[model samples]
Target: MRYTSAIGVTTAITAGLTACGGPASNGDGAQESGGGASGTIEAGLSYPLSTGFDPMITSGATPYAANMHIFEGLVDLDPATLVARPALATGMPKKINATTYRATLREGATFHDGSAVTADDVVFSFERVLDAKNASLMAQFVPFLDTVKAVDTSTVEFRLKYAFALFPSRISVVRIVPKKIVGADAKAFDAKPVGSGPYRFVSAVREDKIVMEKYEKYNGPHPAKAQKMVWHLMSDPSARVSALQSGRVQAIEDVPYIDMKGFTGKNKVESVQSFGLLFLMFNCKDKRFADKRVRQALHYALDTEKLIKTALLGNAEPATGYVPATHPDYSKAATVYTHDVAKAKKLLADAGVKDLSFTLMLTDTGWVKDIAPLIKESWAAAGIDAKLDIAQSPAQYAKVDKGTFDVLAAPGDPSVFGNDADLLLRWFYYGFWPEKRYGWTGSSAYKKTRSLLDRAASAADENKRKELWSQVTDLVAEEAALYPVLHRKLPTAWTTDTLTGFEPLPTTGLSFVDVGRA
Candidate 1:
């Protein structure tokens, strides 16, 4: 998709908000102002454009947030509720057999380039993702997927390697892309994506902003309700809050926990329970964290309740298991680590380790940054010295993936793909995140966990799958190589007077799929 007009503005709207104590437009032209009866919707995103918008491999916060509007999978996650709903597909795929399924595409669905979205595009999308050379992050989720083929003009068939029950839901990993446009220039396509969604890709500035306008020719269940959208990449928490307060942006995400109560009247704030969690991953290769007992000791030492109340402002719940208590498939793990300083000391003593000193690597996410000191304090109380090495997620993850860090404390939410136990479990344990990333594959525990997860995925019976999942959960909890400390509630602030159909997402980032300016 080709776009014109380079509208530039300052980083933040500080002056206008300082002049007036309430919501008032900064009048920074169309560049920063948005959301009236017939105005563009400017959203203050909490992340910069770190990764380019390639649907298959894009994982960066800003790019992934933008792709939610610019592309649609055969099945798409509902913005408000993360439930899988039909997007490009006419409806949910029909199960033909244990290994085969068919999806009928919605007719007249065209890419932003005005080319018809054919079954060929669907087949190509999945094939590209399935190809090993592309290094798609979605490849691991579809290990069961044997092949995808275009049976007809409007129908696509999926052949699984085994009997996988979550086939319908798992297909959302691959978003459909135009074959001609992408095939011609893959690099250019990544920079500027073209897909059949409500919003068309206009232009994107690396760390400044991303611009998109409603695709008038779009035909889908959740069509764009606004004329245009501009996502201001405000990585700073104060800048985001200022943008919303100044009326320079209609909505803002990652609302600070302390500031939630101050939002009143026309400025609304809501903290929706999200599957997003502050996870702790240990490098199994490190002799220090190699012992499961030491890992368990560290978890037991953490005062999770205190952390949530003080660090997170009670906008989170201690992780009981892999899935939160709110989840439908929630199962309390057999091993529950409930803050016991005495138990932690005893475990460390039993393991024959004294005064543990290790460097803790963390990302620069605002909430995570807030909780980092608390974590160190918890460790200090437990007679452990944890030196902090704070850096951005990409940099921190580079250290994590290379086994350069002792322990990694970062935030992740894969529930946007699917909320199922298998999908959620596989995200950390099954993919490159486990083997190449954290070096957890060497252990017999990893082998057993993988075996149990595989059996669970293939098990036809729901009860059997649950049992297998629980078994894997117990084993992982016992291993303690990686686990969640708490599942956080995503806080979002929006102007109630100017935006309609605006809802806080249970996942990270905001969605304007069906939202409009009042």
Candidate 2:
């Protein structure tokens, strides 16, 4: 497959992957000449276009990253820092009462289609996510939201069921979308998104590349610095490194740990401590795992420290709590899963379990694949027989959603959406994950977790909210029904000579909002 632009630049898209490495061109025949703010910024992305561009339901890491450039919430988070700031809105929403808040859109803000962004667009955005039938992935994040109404063409009002102290930062979960485009054909809008953002969506091919151009009409705070961006979807870590080293692209994300030292002086490589994690989940409905002791046993059996050293090349930290230590709200869990083979065996024996054997389903992510063998070995040493089932994320999740899986070890980082403790914990524990995927909703532990999260969400006092969150973290940690195994570092590589204002993100994907080619 090939894409030829109006400017006569032809991009060859190979089957299952795109070709990497060539001189960086400004989508024209000539190479980028000067360190001006107006050239093409090519990047090597570590994930393919697995999901759509719609902010409401898009869950894939790649698309979520793209949306950071292509859309704006009333408030948006700084990609480099997780700090929330006004984007589409003139400023942060102003509180009117205990449960009411209001915001005025930025004057003259226009969508990618050149339509003036109105309060109605903001209302539509929240309504769709709030509507249960849409099944928006963001619905779980804003459970406190009751209604969103347009006060006028510029002003919008929000009524929350309860006073959520984190409401200002939390609302960043829902990105504002053009109502006319989405309401006309949601499926079409999902594929080709249009938003009032700095960068306009140009084109995307599933396994090839995603292209975006600077939205000239954008009146946002962070306007696009580059004229265009070409994100080559290179899932292979080696390919990503090669693209950066060869100067085919200015930056590359998910740099392999083994190749970090090689890029030392030639390119800047930094590994940021991210909330991203590899988690172990159990089918609590299964009689064998219905016992909390069995779940605890499985968690205790793993040699996490050794796994980090061997599989991750010491790039990850063993899970001490639900969130990583870097998180502001992080608290040490009551029961941290340290390696204890004897304790594991005792717990299994206490449950009267003998010859425990099950299929351990895990994703085929680069790092997770490296850790799989060690997982099986650790379980085997604890007198447990385990079968390894490694597959792509979609396939593995298909079985998990259908309740056909025994156990799963997969990478999850809801911090891509928002980094709040309530938001992160509720992502897996409160909603679809516990109720549908892991089958923990029926348990007493699940009920208690729900209660705790609800109370914490409504707590107006910051200290009280943190106290409540700590209790919930301790509860989830001890249960081990579905909990993190380790929080890994996210490594990114970029060249200073070719790009300016590039910062490695502490989250999953790379960001280029204010970045420009040098």
| Alpha carbon lDDT of each predicted model | 0.82, 0.85
Candidate 2 residue runs with Cα over 4 Å from true position: 1-36
Query: Where is model 2 poorest over a 10-residue stretch in terms of lDDT?
Result: 1-10
For every candidate, C-alpha RMSD to the true structure in Å: 6.5, 5.6
lDDT of 2 by residue, 1-518 (tens): 00111012122322322223223335431343332337888888888766667788777778789899999999999998999999999999999999999999999999988999999999999999999888777888888899999999999999999888899899999999999999999877777788888887777778878888778888778988887788888988898988888878889999888888899665999999999899999998899899989999999999999999998889999999999998999999999889999999999999999999999998888888999999999999999999999988767877877789999998888788888899888888987778887899888989999999999998989899899999999999999999999999999999888777899998888999888766
Q: 1-518 in candidate 1: lDDT tens per residue?
A: 00000001012211111111222332332432323224578899887665667878776666677888999999988877778888899899999999999999998999998999999999999999999888777887899999899999899999999999888888987899999999999877877788899888877767677778778778888877776787887888888998899889989999999888888899999999988888898888888877889999999999999889998899999988888889877888889989999999999999899989999998877888889999999989989899999987656765665568899888888887678899899888875667876678878888888899999999999999999999988888788889999999999999998888899998878898788878
Candidate achieving the largest lDDT: 2
Task: TM-score for candidate 1, please give it.
Answer: 0.92
TM-score of each: 0.92, 0.94
lDDT of 1: 0.82
Clashes of each: 0, 0
For model 1, the stretches where C-alpha displacement exceeds 4 angstroms are 1-38
